[model samples]
Target: MKIYIITVLLILLSMCSCQTDSSPLPILGRHDISETDTVYHRIPDFKFINQDSNYVTNSDLKDNIYISDFFFMSCPSICPIVKKQMLRVYDKYKDNDRVKLVSHTIDPKRDTPEKLKKYAQKLNIDDSVWMFLTGEKGEILDIADDYFVAAFEDPDAPGGFDHSGKMILTDTKRHIRAFAEGTDPEDVDQFLIDIDKLLVEYAQ
Candidate 1:
């Protein structure tokens, strides 16, 4: 009888551990949500021109989950490192139609559609799966704010602009499901796991 009770207790503990590990990632940016409130935040609508000069809006990504980041082509400090990490993410999901990558440039004047095209080509990125976007500088900054990324022009800063190296993951409903430091390989590795979790979440 004692052996049977220990086995039952162990099984129950394992089940509880699974439940804890499987809890969904939180919906960020809830300003007024109470403990009992279950409100979810979502990315707002915006339009921008992609590398191919095609307009991309929230509606365009309605059925897909995507990763988003902000950078300028001329950034000399963190952009290259962040892009390398992003490339890892790209390689992981390149063949999955449900996933996409959106890179918004803070320097619109310098990162025009043509320039972005060449950058993508140099990086060997698939324009169909990844979009390098540029538009009015102020508009791009506003959209960056929507993603909780800081971007601005700093004449004193390196390469004429300053921006955070943050990569955000959003689900099909436009909810921000997770994020990671774009410069940290370990954080990005965990982010990849989060991406898989979101994929499994919606697949169910």
Candidate 2:
């Protein structure tokens, strides 16, 4: 996760977090510079099965802003804390038609759609509001990098894998807007404000 932090920080260094003048949230990613125009990075296309066993793709979410994260059901360390923060995000926008939450499981071998369904059911959250995803492990890990959430198998780590608990906020255009350390309630409090601010951009 060290590499993920450095990468995110490097991208963040060139951007601002607060739009005090009520501007849109900063797009967080690498940029392709050119004399004519600059092109920003975007979350790459991917697909996975949600808790309902339905296939979900980027095109399905092209019209909505979403929060994305990584986790495994068996995580013995920070998963609970991170999930608590995510629930905060979920409750805040569960009824909003324009928002969704996507959680990709790093341990796809164990965290299947049915398992995810039970997990979601335990929280009493509808799949339309927050999706728990699982797919090919390689694809999952690659997409995790795209979202700046480190995830990989680690024999020495807890639960037999290492991962980051970063909750990422992304816009409809696939640009990352804001993120928070999911283990920190205070950071997530600010993240909630960021979500509201991002929504205001769409309202405009």
Candidate 3:
């Protein structure tokens, strides 16, 4: 009787442990940017303008994978470096119709569609896969907030806009799977690898 009781107790303990481990963790929101080995919540739905001034909504992003970053055409510092890195990414995935890039302008006042078009042309941005978008300042900020990709206006800054240098990777389901520093080469490489893993997950 004692032996049977001990075995039953052990089994029940194991089951309890399993159940405890199966519970989902609390999700962190944009204001609480997670820095640990934590999974991000699903991407929030949004609507914004594309390079062509067309309305691009979350539904349009369905069934397509995309990489996104924020920048202004006239940014004099890290923007150029980030753009250079993005050029490499653009080259790698330009031929793949399944992949696309969205570059949002932090300086909507100066990055009008015409200005953005010239900037894209100057960089030879592969529009087939890459788009330089300019829209209302508040709209861009809201979308950035949803992604937890930080951006703000700094009165002291030359362009008055400050933004995070993250390269956001999203799946076909319009979910953000991963992100990396836009100016970091190793991070960008890891981002590419993550993109492949996300593609596999989406495929499965």
- By TM-score, rank the candidates, best first: 1, 2, 3
Residue 108 accuracy (lDDT) in model 2: 91
Q: For candidate 3, write residues 1-204 as lDDT tens digits.
A: 999999999999998887732222223343335676544556676666666777777677677788899988878768988888788778888887778888889888878877777778888776557877777788888888766788989988766788878888777655566787988999998777777766565554
Cα shift from native, residue 190, model 1 (Å): 0.5
Question: Of the candidates shown, which would achieve the greatest TM-score relative to the real structure?
Answer: 1
Off by over 4 Å in 2: 1-21
| Candidate 1 weakest lDDT stretch, 10 residues | 20-29
Candidate 1 per-residue lDDT over residues 1-204, each given as its tens digit: 999999999999998887745778877776567889766777878899999999999889998999999999989999999999999999999999999999999999989999999999999989989999998888899878878998888899999998899999998888898999999999999999999888987785
Return the lDDT, model 2, position 131.
Answer: 94
What would the per-residue lDDT of candidate 2 be over residues 1-204, giving only the tens digit for each residue?
A: 999999999778756653255666799988899999988878989889999899999999998999988999999999999998899999999999999999999999999899999999998898888999999999999998888788899999999889999999999999999999999999999899999999997885
TM-score versus the correct structure, for each prediction? 0.90, 0.88, 0.76
Instruction: Give the lowest summed-lDDT range of ten residues in model 2.
Output: 14-23
Alpha-carbon lDDT, every model: 0.91, 0.91, 0.76
Ranking by lDDT: 2, 1, 3
Number of backbone-clashing residue pairs for each candidate, in the order shown: 0, 0, 0
Poorest stretch of ten by lDDT in candidate 3: 20-29
Relative to the unseen true structure, what is the C-alpha lDDT of residue 78 in candidate 2, on a scale of 0 to 100?
Answer: 93
